[model samples]
Target: MSAALDQPAAVRLSLADALRSARETRALLVGPGVLGETGRLFREQFPGRRAVVVADPETRTVAADAVAAALAAAGIGTEPMYLFPGAGLYAEFGYVTRLEASLCRHDAIPVAVGSGTINDLAKLAAHRTGREGYLCVATAASMDGYTAFGASITHEGAKQTFNCPAPRAVVADLDVIRRAPDWLTAAGYADLSAKLTAGADWILADALGAEPIEPRAWAIVQGGLRAALADPAGARAGRIEAIGPLVEGLMLGGFAMQWTKSSRPASGAEHQFSHLWDMEHHVHGGEAPSHGFKVGVATLAVTRFYEAVLACDFERLDVAAAVAAWPAPETEEAAVRRMFAGTDFIATAVTETRAKHPAPAELSAQLERLRRDWPALRRRLQAQLLPAAEIERRLALAGAPTAPEAIGIPPARLRSAFRRAYHIRRRFTVLDLAVRTGQLERLLDAAFGAAPASTAP
Candidate 1:
């Protein structure tokens, strides 16, 4: 629909306009010297600013030093904040308190020096303290929250989504991203990959009036996926040239939803799956994996699961037959709870939601339409992601883990993770689709037996 910003200047204005139409124009500047370019842009965008560099200990010792040196060289006074390490951890209320205290302590204007959590926390802090700031260096290409005007933080030990202001400017340093753990990059790729499942879900939501879609925003998202998939090496390297577009695409994706004050553009079955996994991990005293990692596998599962559903000749069944085929609540409950054991809220949300809104007739109708249109949608998706096999191969090339077990999950745990995963978040995703269709159990059985093909371009 739309080409990503700076997607080869010669790639046709219609395409460029298409992409831009969907997203607010974000400033994406790339150069061999990103620090200087970014610093210059920062001054140009908002002048007369005192700077606070909110960084993780590792980044502060490494990337933040260079950022400080660059700002100082540019004659800007800078302050340093050695933030606590880890993703999601940095955005905690406690961390926010520490940062608020630090802001007052140094009278610093918040500017983050790391990516993902650091950027999110800094952005939140800036929103709270009314400061202007940007990201310096980091990995975490996984989550779409980076550029969105919202933050998912833990409140009272439960993961909650909070309204957050978008960054005044975002400065992503590719050098740091490429060198960081491969899981982070792979997670980022997985996040991008989930767009299809999300896109499909978004389409269904819009069709049923559950959500609205903007053609312009959809185009930009489509274009961004194309650019990311087209350049495999650049994605792995985290260089400015490669990462600039990725960050831009993510920003556009976030904006597509943010501008509309909705999340339909960037979430779907895969996100639900990821959220469930997140909850399960928390419940079992298990470590959390990257958002992208969970979404990646979830995306694959949803795609295959849906494809199988489409293959079923539903027209042959009468309404009574379909009704009888619906999954029982006890079965659904047990599966969901077992799948998402660690997170009570997630399991409860999913189980309760299905109980309240049983829409098998509607779900069946939509499945019919989806089956008829599956070919077109599949072509469109393939045009963007290639095949599922290629996506798996690319993930492997990046040294990113693929299956649940790859990320330190045991087989039984993963099975449970899949079953209960739908309960973690409030979103209309493929997991929801399976739940609504009364086919989740059979799908789970198949999942354990046959690894589905990739849906990536």
Candidate 2:
């Protein structure tokens, strides 16, 4: 099939049009051999601006040097590149502070020359230093944060999204990305695959009147998801043909987030699992799992939970009984406290849980709406999600870990996460659905054997 024909209609717009539609980003060049145009692209976006390249030692060898050379060739003045430690670097606030210090010393725009961590650091630092926006030189097809607004940074033992604009311009060269380590490419593919569960969560939220779906933002992320994820094997083999769609899908997710000014467009319940892990300081083999790896496993778990939900006969739901059984505000807060005991996230969890906790009347209304809308909502969710086994198959083909154990999460711990994750985010998802209907413990028992804790009121 022709490339244009293979792409979803929503993303067939020219690059210029895509950039113009973005809220903050203005330019994007994604193709093989686009790295050399970095200087020209930055110049077009911000004229007469000096550049400062930010990279880790590893990325410096991979693409930063070439980026600096290109800027010099274009006669764009540059400050000395700031390099962070390559080893054990993560998206922590300390790195952002250090980068901010470096940026504060000069008025030059930053050119972030790495993947997720590098981009987030430069993004927040640039925003803090009062720069309009920075440029991004992507070295891998790792995550969708390349053009997404807000940096996911760990601060005060919680994973927080610090508000920040995406890069003014982004240049992603497929050659460099295709050459990235197999795990990195696999991680990106898995992250992109998460849109399946994310979309289903959005559909569920919309059905329950929790959060209405945004059609434009939806199209931006979901239009081309299947096509982007069609060839996991090709992505694993590092073929540009496969890498191209993968990177494009990841970028489109960011654009969707930028348009909505929220991560809701790109993240959902799957991300909640990842966030919970981050907050808990989950590490396997003395290393934290990549965001994509955690989400990949969470996607599989959420998909199975959706299957269980789909099998239920919602037509006979006892709305009045469910509403009467709902926990009061204080009862829910106490549960949140117990769930997050001995953690810094207890206060935050209590706050978020309260935000979504509904009164008896409100719960009744929502349950009525759910019972009224479930037939169609189920169809929408079924259409949005693939089978859990199929998701695992694709993730395995793409080289991502398909099981929680592979990423150092015990099966028992994962079951606990299903409930704890709900308290950490006010976002309505399948988790909330299970909780409200008193099906959470049953579903958890079915999915991961039996656990001692009661998850639903």
Candidate 3:
């Protein structure tokens, strides 16, 4: 993989080349007026298949009606639209089940007509009904699940990524997306910003041999990221020039995830914070916070963690002593139980922690590798990450909440999340690195001013 990375940079791919590289998605039309061409694109991608428009009450007004009319004009057969309530809609299993029931009654392909929540619900529902794929008419420059495989839905009180194919086609009309509420676009910008930390996490994992970076996947997500993120102020103000790249960046992330067959290409520890909050049902202002907002705050937190890790002198580390001090399997399990004591997700947490928990021998080997690779790894990570203050600046300029309290997470709770989030996923990230080296608590103290109560047994 490093050999591939060392090769001369490939020319940026055209949209056609990108679509071909994706595992499932076949067509993408993104422009100011592409919403009007949805029927034509759908016909080109799914000839002779009837269609059903899936949306909520608000989106029905936003684009669903126009989509239905477009299909009719194109002579495509259409089923009655399946409308979820505009309010209280979420990506949860019950909603998926309801949408599945509606989809099961028709043989038509679902044309999802909203952003993150609607797309996820329709993607999972269509997959459940044995449909080859669905069409996504994006209404906002929100999160990047549009052309990505799988759906992030809450099931059994935990946020889990259910295995499913992405939409066969996607249509993002910049005119519609630009008209979306400012915060929605801001959220999209922040979500895209998280790729910085995510990329750094991937570099760390690659160095540790936990997960090696795939060159193609890395290129797809990272190539246009900085340019896309360059004008957060313009994006927040709904400028097409800024929103265009923001949408493109978000879409490219999905394509990278498609190429990799995993979200590792686009997600890392920052995403874990969002997932942990989802499982906890954390709410602000009487509603669950938007995914991008949670992730924006988490990205800053993780960036600070990276700063601490980067400052460490790994060359002087005592690998033998660290291995000897590593927690036993049972001790780790007990700590996980303590961290999740009142939640129904304790079992899930325990299972995930145990899956990635390294034994003494394995810890020694991994630590030795880290010690050996520290210099090169540190340089790579430094190249990939932005300063925490700079990330906060971009996020604020984009109109996203810059602090945890802005999204309803108190400082103490956020501190606790630094630990709890680690146990919820088997993914190897900076959090895992900190824990293995006995630096997590110290990192937390530095990032949060003081560490919260320990969950350690």
Best-fitting candidate, scored by lDDT: 3
The whole-model lDDT of each prediction reads 0.58, 0.87, 0.88
What lDDT is obtained when candidate 1 is compared to the true structure? 0.58
lDDT of each residue in 174-270, candidate 1, tens digit only:
5555566656766777777777667766655554334545565565565456665455466676665666555555656665665566776677776
Per-model TM-score on C-alpha atoms: 0.78, 0.94, 0.94
Tens-digit lDDT string for candidate 2 (1-457) = 1122222234443345456658988788899999999999988988999999999999999899999999999999999999999998999999999998888888999999999988998899999999988999999998888999889998876678898888888999999999998999989998998998898888778778898877777777887788899999999998989999999889888888888888897899999999999989888999889999999899989888888888887878998888878988998888778878899879889989999998888888888888887887777777788898899899999999988999999877888888899998999999999999877888776766677555332
Give me the runs in candidate 2 sitting further than 4 Å from their true place. Answer: 1-18, 156-158, 452-457
Error of 3 at 21 (Å): 2.1
- What tens digits encode model 3's per-residue C-alpha lDDT throughout 103-151? 8787999999999999999999999999988999999998888888889
lDDT for position 110 in model 3: 95
Candidate 2 weakest ten by summed lDDT: 1-10
Model 2 alpha-carbon miss at residue 253, Å: 1.0
